[model samples]
Target chain A: MKELIQLIASFVGAIGFSLIFGLHGKQILLAGIGGACTWGVCLLTDFLGCSLPLAIFFAAVFGSFYSECLAKILRVPKTVFLFSVLISLIPGSNLYLAMRYAIEVNRELAMANAIETLTVALAISLGIIVMLVTSQIQARIKSRGNRN
Target chain B: MSLTSVREKDRMADAAGVVRLALDVGEQILLSGGEVGRVEDTVLRICTSYGAVRTDVFAITSLVFVTAVWENGEIVTQSRRIKEVGKCMRRLEELNSLSRRICTERPTLAEAEKAFSEIMKRSESSWVKVLIGSLLAATAYTAFFGGDLKDCLVAPFVAAVIFGSQFLTKKIGGNKFFSQALCSFLATAAASFAVAMHLGSSVDHIMIGCIMILIPGISVTHAVENLIIGDTIAGLISLSEALVIALALAGGFALSQSLFGGLLI
Candidate 1:
């Protein structure tokens, strides 16, 4: 039940961003679903006792692959899906607390939070890079086969 | 062979036209927050399909370089220095679609230019749409972080004030860093006000949701992709841009953290 509500919340967040990003046509709903999927994978991994970074990595991989597939299907740029799909993955709260800890003079907690934030950022990037590399390699092999 | 053939000169002018059209497409893609690879590919594809013997397209965050060579050994080059960047997925979609057609169907220069202009002339997003969208975004962000109904209810109001100030700042056109901080100050202030009224439970949670609206999600995404795709130069530029924006966003909340809610951790 909790997971379901979180999924809906993630969906709503993406819909809101779809509006702000000026996404058009059927993309609005697709973007919302993309967010829900990211959140779901993230929550599931985190619940399975994986580290936070690992959870983010898995979620990001799913989200980026989803974006590529949706882009191909929708015939729009991948960014349309990229934005809404990854919104829920961003470590917004972690960054906020890091800033707060910095301001409050708790240098230790601030540094720890800051480093953790970096981990999340890196995990998300790693996920994107993984998907990007896989897709590029697939394209290369296909192109080579066409030549043969 | 030097300067006697008027027909040769006319062919050179046609090459220039193709280069210009290619640059226009690239400029729109870059301006609309496209990846470096996408921008480069679209420009090259359009130039090649339009009969350019050779083409080179290089784009970064703030500038675009497009060069095309004609069969007559005439070279045409154009550079567009982008002064601003904004997000409009619709424009990006249109550019992608148009580039596909240009590559496959080979539209004439005039036809392609006409189509590109029409894409640019699409109506600006109405303010009402933006405002409502922003409102929804902030409220939904609040819920994403596990905020209760009261927090969600208050966020849209806060988002309205933030958007209003953002609009005002546009008219004045002051320093970007200062404006970013100013926006953060306003958002934090509103969240603090709600906390003071006993309408919300945790200031950190609520403020986290509110400030989530300002984080540079798209910029960071592009920055990461650029860095990995061997576009070290463009990637680093946008990465720094994203870092600075993130710092400014944090600075915004830090500047007002004391004045609001007393560091409710």
Candidate 2:
């Protein structure tokens, strides 16, 4: 239950933040929910001591799908939804830390942090692409059915 | 008419025509060794007395005319200015040359490849860029005072808030100044809470993360880019925006610290 509440908070935070970019309240709210669920998955994987990379990959893929669904239902742009939802998973701090390390001439630590950040970014980008492809397929099928 | 007298009159008319053309073509009347005051005074007078449309001009290498939208869907364009004639000629020549170049380049795969490479080069490297920025900030903090894992880990929230503010400010439809202020205050207060609640690892850690978020990275980047590209006026505008936002973030932090003095993390 506590975890669930935190997930909700994360969702609210993501949605609230999304509003700054001219996103509609409803659309952002849905994005927040999607982001929250994705974050929950990542948190759970961490708690279970599983590979974080894998968790991030899965979370992104799922997040994309949820974003697409919300976009369809809400009649907003899917790119907006997906990008907003993906915000929850961005390793914003890790990048900051890596920079700090480099400035201080801590080469080893900086390199290590930098590598991890790169991997996380790659995973998220891959996941988003996958989700985009899937959504396109779904859209194609929906359009085809309507024609018949 | 006396020959010398007519010659002097013609020179004066040509000078007036040059000024008019410059004003009409939307060229910055303030050019190399040009003075803005004279152009401004002339424009004001022309607008007031002659019913000529006076425009807000931006100074760069030349005066830039920036009247994209107008009242009641009507756009008033005056073409009698010499500046307008010069600008149109240059534009036409450029367009013709570009078409010729495109045609020639289409057949050369190497040229197309070079064009693509140039486009990619213009965009920043997404992965390495973020990584380097984070690494530098982290190392500075960590080396000054040994590692704090929890705080460092949670610092991203502050980063998020800073980044999030850009989006929030745009979406909220509030005054840009007010939105920035509110965002900074909320971001600092949130960072304080995150640290105090033990949810975030450390105060310093969170501050480092959140502080950058408010740093007008985009505006600063734009200012630098414009300056490097030789658009002095654009660079100035971007720099101003960056300065305002940075001050707003600082003000927000100061206010938060003062309000909850003893309770601050």
Candidate 3:
């Protein structure tokens, strides 16, 4: 039940951001759905005993895939959807904790949280890079085949 | 000689017009927070579509430079300096579609300019919508971050304070970092006060929730994307910007927490 509410919260959060970003109509709803599904994937991976960073990585992979496919179908840039979809996994709270600890002179705790934040950030970016590279390669092969 | 010179002048003006149009599209994309790669690619495509035999484009977060060579080897170079970057996904979509249409249809300069103006005119959303968006984001993220119903309920009021501060800063033409710090400080102070008044349960969750709305997630993602695409300069510029904004947000929150230490949990 808690997970379900969190998913809903993620959806609402995405929708709010979509509005803030000036997305309208169907795009907002699609972004919301995408955000919910991304969080759901993260939760599922975490439930399966995956590490938190690994779970976020998988979630980002799914989110990027979702946005790429949607962009193709909708004839829009992928970032429009990608931004809102991945909003739920940005590790904002952890970053805040790191800042707070640093200010309080808790050097060890701040260093630990800062490293964790960087790791999670790296994982998310790597996931996005993997999908992007794959898509570029696929496009190249398809274009080459057409020329042949 | 006079007749030939007049004709040459006309040709030069025509080529300059095409280059200007292409640069205009690229600038809009950059200003609307499109990726540097996409902005460069779109400019190149648009110039080539308009009969440039060769085109070279260099784009970073704040500037775009393009030089196009015509069939007769005449060259036109143009550059645009983008002063501000803001996200408007709808405008980005419209600009993307406009670029695609220009490439496929090769519209006349007047027609393309008209279309671009129309997109710009429709890009500004009402202030009410933005306020509502802030409220909703603050409330929903509060819940998502483990805030109970009371905390969630209090988050919107705190969000309103942040929104008002942001609006005031914008009106005063304050710098980005100062405005961000002001908004974060106000948000933290309001959240702490609410918790002290028994209007909410947890200050941490509320502050985190409000911070989610202010985080530079899109900029960070775009920076990474730019780096992967080999636009290293643009990537680094944006990455540094994200870091500064994050630091400012933390600074604001820390100041507020210190002032209201007893009220915050």
Which model scores highest in DockQ?
A: 3
TM-score, candidate 3, is 0.95
Please give, for residues A1-148, the per-residue lDDT of candidate 1 as tens digits.
6677678888988888887777877888898999998989999999999999999999999999999999988778888788778888888888887888888889999899888877888889889999989998999999999999
Q: Residue B103 of candidate 1: its Cα lDDT?
A: 88
Candidate 3 fnat reads: 0.67
The residue-by-residue lDDT of candidate 2 on B28-117, one tens digit each, is 222211223333433333322222233443443233342212222323333222221011111222222322343343222234335433
When candidate 2 is compared with the true two-chain complex, its DockQ is: 0.02
Better of 1 and 2 by lDDT: 1
- TM-score for each predicted model, relative to the true structure: 0.93, 0.42, 0.95
Error of 2 at B49 (Å): 46
Docking class of 1: medium
- Per-residue lDDT value at A138 in model 1: 98
Q: What share of the true interface contacts does candidate 2 keep?
A: 0.01
Model 3 spans > 4 angstroms off: B1-13, B263-265
Tens digits of per-residue lDDT, candidate 3, B1-265, equal: 6975665445455888888988998998888778888999999998888778899999998899999999878899999988878888888899999999998987777798899989989886667877888898889898997889999999999889988998899899968998999989888899989898889998888888888888886688778777877889999999999999998998898899899856455
Interface quality of candidate 3 as DockQ? 0.73
The C-alpha lDDT values of all candidates are 0.82, 0.50, 0.88
Q: What DockQ class does candidate 2 belong to?
A: incorrect
